[model samples]
Target: MAQTGIADRAARNGHAADEGGAGLAGRLLGGLARQVQQRIPAADLDERDPDYIRESLPRQWLLASLWFRGEVRGLGNIPESGPVLLVGNHSGGNMTPDTIVFTLAFYTYFGVERPFYQLAHNLVVSFPQLSFLRKFGTVAASPENSAKALQAGAALLVYPGGDRRSLARGLGLDRLFRLKVLPISLALPWGINVGDFLGHIPLPAKITVEALPPIDLREEFGQQPDLDEVYDHVMRLMQDTLDALAAERRLPVLG
Candidate 1:
C-alpha cells in the first residue's frame, strides 16, 4: 500500500508539470497571435497609428511594476515589413539588461512580439535550463542562424561588441565590433532594413533608438556572393544610425 501511494503521488506531480507546461505554451502562443493582430499594413505604417501603443501598453505596465523603468524612443522609424537588423552594445553581465529592456520596449511601443534572437555563446544555450531561453528568441549568433532569420522576414538584434566590450574589465569607450555585420550583410540583399539603438549608460541609463535608411542592395547585388563588400555596406549604415542617435542624447528615465 505504501509503494502504491508513492507511485500515485509521482503520477500526480507529473500531471501538474504537464499542466504547467501547457499553460506556458498557451501564453507564448497568445503573445505571438497578438503580434499578428496588431500588425499594421505595410503601406499604412506611415500613419504612425496608435494601435501599437494599445498592444504594447501591457508590457510597459509590467515593466513599471517591476520598478525597471527606462525610456525607449524612436518608434516612428521601424520598417513595416521585411527583415531588419538591430545592432547595439552588449552588456557583459549575466543576462544583459539592455537586451531585455530594449526588447520590452520594442514589444510594448511597437506592438511587435518578435523577440530579439540573441546570438548567445554556444555554451549558454547548450545547457538545459538556459536552452529554454531560446523560446524568448535566443539563438546562436552564427552566420547560418542570421541568414535564416532574414530569409524568414524576422527582425534580429545584435551586439557587435559581444559580452567582452560591454562587460569590459577596463573601458574607456572602445570601438564597436563588427560581429553583427555578418547578419547585416545577409539581411541587406534580402532588402532588410537596419536599425541601431544607443543608450544604457549604466543603472541611470536611457535608451535612444534610430532607424537607418534601408541599405539599398538591389542595385549592388546581381544574385552573387560579395560578402566582404556587403559587410562593409551594412556596417556603414549601422554606424551611421548609432552615431546619429548617440549625438542626440535624449535619455528619458521612467519612474
Candidate 2:
C-alpha cells in the first residue's frame, strides 16, 4: 500500500525530528525515527516470547501483592525442594495474575528456584497476543506435555476447574472448586509429592494461600486411569481439604 511505503522510508531514515544527540539512545531512536518518517509503528514487525520471560519478581511480587491486596498464609507449607502440584480455584477474567502472585509468593517466602511450569489453555497457544503469555514457562495442559513436565521433575501449578470454573458466568462468587485428578495420577506414578494449596479468596478482597498437606498419589494411581473416575476422585479429595480448612478458620484458638 502507499501508506506502507511512507512508513518504510521513515523507519529507514530514523525520525530526525526527534533526534537530538547521537548516542545509544539516539541509535535506538533513529530506528524508530525511520518508521515514523513514513509509516506507523504497526506497519513494522513485532516479536513475542512463547516461554516465561525473565522478570524482576521482587518488583512483580510487590505490585502483584498490592494488586490482590490479600494476605498469604501457610507459605511454610510448601516443600523446600521437590516436585509439587499446586491445585487451586480460578476466578473468571484473569487467573494468570493470581497464579503469578502465588508463584512469586512461593519464590519470595520459600526461595524456590525450580521453574514453576503452569498449564495453559489451548487457545493461548493458538492466538497471537495471548500466545505471548505462553512464554512464561507454561506448557499446554495436554496428556503428553503434563506427563513430560512431571517426569522431568518440574513443579506444576494448575487450576483443575480450567476455564469452566475460572471463567464462570458470575463474578465475585465462591473461590472453592473441585480439583482435577489427572495431576494426582501423574504425580503418583512419578513419585512426585502433591500439595493441595487452598486459596480462600474473596473477590475484590484480601487473598489467603493456605498451603495444606501433600496428597499422596500412590493409592489413587493404583486405580484405573479413566479420566472421569480420576476427576471425580480428585474432586472429592480437594473438596474435603477445602472444607477442613474452612472449619479450621471457624475454630477459636487459645494461646
Candidate 3:
C-alpha cells in the first residue's frame, strides 16, 4: 500500500511538471506572436521579390559595368542548387560599393528568381531611404535569420567583419578611429563630408570582388562543429584571396 501511494505521488508530480512546461511554452509562443505583430508589416521582409529585382537590373548593370567596373571570379564554385554562404571581405566604407557590385553580378549571372539573400546591419534595413534594399532581399543580420535562409535553400551573402570591422580592416584604419569618426561623419547634417562618400565623388576604384568556394558546414565541420575553427578557416580563405587581388592592383583607384 505504501509503495502504491509513493508511485501515485510520483506520477502526480510528473504530470504537474509536464503541465507547467506546456504553460511556459505556450506563453513564450504567445509573446513571440505579439512581437511579430507589433513589427511593421511592410518592414518585415522575410523574402525576396524576383519581379522587383528584375526591374532594377538595368541600374545594377550600369553600376557594375560602368561605375565600379567590378569583376567577380569563382562563379563555378557556387553549387547549382543548394544552400550556400558567400562570405567576402566588405569594402568602400558605410556605403559598401563592393556589396552592391557583387549582388548585381550574382543576380545577373544566376538570374533574380533564384533564392538569394544578403545579410546587412539592422540600421541599413531600418533607415527610411534604404527601404529599397528590402526589395532586393537584404535582410538584417542575425543567426536565426541566416539559418532560416539556408534552410529555405537560399544562397546567403554575409560579411562576418560587418560594417565597422570590415571598413576599418579594408581601409587600414584603426578600429577606434573608424568607430569614432564614422558616426560623426554620418550624422553631419551639412552632407559635405560624409565619411562613406570617400570624397565629393566615389573614387573610380576598380573593385575586384571574388567568390570563394562555398562551405557546407555539415560536410566540413560534422554534426558537432567547432565554430572558432570554422571562423578562422573562412577568414584565412578571404585573406588569401584579398592578398592575391591586392597584388594584382597596379594603383589605388586605377586597378
Estimated TM-score for each candidate: 0.47, 0.50, 0.67
TM-score of 2: 0.50
Better of 1 and 3 by TM-score: 3
Per-candidate Cα RMSD to the true structure, in Å, reads 16.6, 17.7, 14.1
| Residue 113 CA displacement from its true place in model 3, Å | 0.6
Candidate 1 — which residues are off by over 4 angstroms? 1-69, 91-94, 109-116, 126-132, 162-202, 220-237, 240-244, 247-255
What tens digits encode model 2's per-residue C-alpha lDDT throughout 83-169? Answer: 566666543343345565566665566543465566666544445655544454565554345445545555666665545333221
Report the backbone clash tally of model 1.
1
Better of 1 and 3 by lDDT: 3
Candidate 1 has an lDDT of 0.46
Question: CA lDDT of 229 in candidate 3?
Answer: 60
lDDT of each: 0.46, 0.46, 0.60
| Candidate 2 total steric clashes | 19
Ranking by TM-score: 3, 2, 1
Please give, for residues 55-110, the per-residue lDDT of candidate 3 as tens digits.
98887778666866777776666776666666665663577767777787788888
Off by over 4 Å in 3: 1-47, 162-194, 197-201
